[model samples]
Target: MVFIQKGNNPLLAVKAFVQGIGLLGNPKLRKFVLIPVLINFLVYGVAFALGYLYLADIIDQFIPGWLQWLRWILWPLFFISFFIAGFFTFTVLANLIAAPFYGMLSAAALALLSGESATITEAPWPKVIKAELNRAAYLGSRAIPLVILSIIPGINVLAPVLWALFGAWGMALEYLAYPLENAGILFSEQRKLIGGVRWGALSFGGLAAAGLALPLINIIVAPAAVIAATIYVREIETDNAR
Candidate 1:
């Protein structure tokens, strides 16, 4: 079935991304993706530091006259922020860490399913995997600078949209590259394939964010997002090839 329908359902798209990650292998590749993802961690760390230094006092001022009651309310809010932030920080980190392995695994799985094992054995495992990961990382990392820039005066207002779109594109790149590689397609080909079903992918990508959205489920969000992406990629390949 063509899972990437013309309709734009954000939840479905995210669900698909989570499914994609389940198809992944290679512990080493997962570790490799972590390096770039740590860059994101560092960025978030700076945000935390700044918030503590500059915003904590401002938050205290808003606590009102009921110090006892106010403390209870503000305490939860403060803790929640840390929890939510850490959750998303790591989910993105996982995607950044797992892209290369996902790419190779996607290619291998599709090739085997396509009755092309003979040729699959000749696949350039290292070159293709690394290239795909690098491209995905490049696209994913585009959001980092935007995030930093968003803190600037005028640009801070635009942060939400820019961050969301950058995030969507990053998810699209990382998720789509695997199936494209599995089918022996290049980055350009993968882009075209995803472009054809852009809305669907975006929808799924958004849904994948839900796991990262809530603090409790965030623990599973990273692997879940990867699995969803794998499923979506496989569906896209199956639909187009048929």
Candidate 2:
């Protein structure tokens, strides 16, 4: 991961995501990345099942009889809309499930950045889990309003954009937490670092935002996003150094 850009370039920020995918070539990174990927897979597998088996049926109930004439057009659009909306819903929920492990993953990703072997010292699970749960709760609470708006007919129209932007911002915050935390940077400082290169942050977020909307890709996106965000942070620091 060469420093792709010195300044906050939106396109470079977006490219950071691609760089993340490239980083998986490390092979060792794959071992650690799988933890989050599998966790997300199992949780989302059940979610996909439930959505396929029940959610659509429930949503179909909301379609009025008068709209039956437009079933072909409306149903596809609705399902597609729901699929995209599910990206945010599922990403938020999956992150909550995997939060306990993210710090470890983020730390590992950071280590990998240094060309160091990602030998993670086992953390105290109880304490770590508690902290993660609290963090997830905070993030969850922030996400709830957007999740609710996604279901309401009038407001759901805006749900995609709102949820995408919100989810991406959360991605920036969550993935960067471990590396930044390690550096003794607090949230205020984290915000400043990210805010300085706002477009870079959003571009990183945007790729993540788009990834969440994808199908199979969504499964692997979180860890990749974390790795990408780590690289992004390092690039910021490197750029500052120069």
Candidate 3:
């Protein structure tokens, strides 16, 4: 394992993300990544099929016949809204379902990074599920206000900027939770640690979010993000220990 020296660089997150992409070819980590990829593929396949089949009907229901002309204007906006909502919703659902595997993946990645033998342990499923639910609730509480802001007349202009920032921050917290939780760090403590290096965390997650929004590429992003997050958390710990 090659370790990058710690520094006060703002681009550390970018480096970590690139390194993480490189690490995906590792035989040791491939199995851990496989399951999540398969899950994503299956979930997304069904979602796309369903959306294609009913999207027209769904739009028609929302827009009355008198307002049919508005479809041209609202169609693009509807697609954007659906894509954003579906991405976040399915990401959360997929992670929740695969939480245990992610926990193991995080542990293995940490071990590999530390140049120690990879020890795959059975995660405490109940605890893992509970932790995932907690994160969902945390994201939901904040997202509700953002959703409302996005609907307002004038103030809504700033909502996109706020949502982008929040999405990046949320992505950081979401992935970082895996490794930190495996190390027995509490959720609150994980936030504080990531908050200490907010810029790097956001950069890492922003890239992850971008990858996730792309078609086909998103299948690999989940596991890569997990590994990248493991790397990020390790760096954070090393820096703080100094």
Candidate 4:
């Protein structure tokens, strides 16, 4: 009975995310959710360990000797920037690896929400791979500029905030792509549809991004996000049909 009325309500995104988490306990979705959770657990564990070990060294290389005095201020900013960047970078990699499983999960979730049969055909892998590459390219085109900005002294102050916002948007688009793609929505059309409901997308993405940063909770966030995105997209399509 988890449902959302379609509109621009940003809060709808929050509700959808919660509903997704709730739905995880449903007997119907548990199987679909398991593999993605395992994938995320492995990816997240490695990313966290690597970040803990090498992130400071990476940050040091970015700051020049003359900027040593600014370490107190810059350290925090760079840490936030790197953390966000690294998180999303690894997230993209994880998603690429899990795309097929995610497609099946999306299909099942979509079927559940739409009250249709849960059985799904094997996802078209070629289309799924193409869609993932398109998303990676789209995110990279923007990420490069943000990475460049994060190293510049004066302007770098804004890098953390900017990176955070971009991360949220990218995540929203990333998760939404699965269900949309399953529905045979093209990448271009997906962007347009998400753009039409930007606020809700951002909020949902922001919450998901924030959740992923948490330790134990992050293991489940990916699959939940997939479900949430499915719910969000389903509601939007329903509204359009009205």
In order of appearance, the predictions have TM-scores of 0.54, 0.76, 0.85, 0.94
What are the per-model C-alpha RMSD values against the true structure? Answer: 7.9, 4.0, 3.7, 2.7
Whole-model lDDT for model 3 versus the true structure?
Answer: 0.77
Which parts of model 4 have CA positions greater than 4 angstroms off? 1-6
Q: Compute the lDDT of residue 209 as modeled in candidate 4.
A: 93
* lDDT, candidate 4, 1-242, per-residue tens: 11234546887888889999989978788988898889998999999999999999999888889989999999889889999999999899889888898888888888888788867766778877888999999999999999999988889999988988998899988998888777777888878778877888889999989998898799899899999988887776776676
Q: Assess each prediction's global lDDT (C-alpha) against the native.
A: 0.53, 0.68, 0.77, 0.86
Q: RMSD in Å for candidate 2, one decimal? A: 4.0
Looking at candidate 2, what is the lDDT of residue 211?
Answer: 78
Model 3 per-residue lDDT tens digits across residues 1-242: 11233422558777777878888889888888889889988877766777778766664564556766866865555455445655777778888988888888888888889999966987889999999998899988988987666544345556556767877888888898898888788788877777766777788778887888777898888888899888876886676676
Q: Model 2 segments beyond 4 Å from truth?
A: 1-7, 63-85, 116-119, 124-135, 142-144, 147-155, 186-189
User: Candidate 1: which stretches are off by over 4 Å?
Assistant: 1-93, 103-125, 213-216
lDDT of 3 at 42: 85
Ranking by lDDT: 4, 3, 2, 1
Give me the candidate number with maximum lDDT: 4
Residue 68 Cα positional deviation in candidate 4, in Å, after optimal superposition:
1.4
Determine the backbone clash count of candidate 1: 26
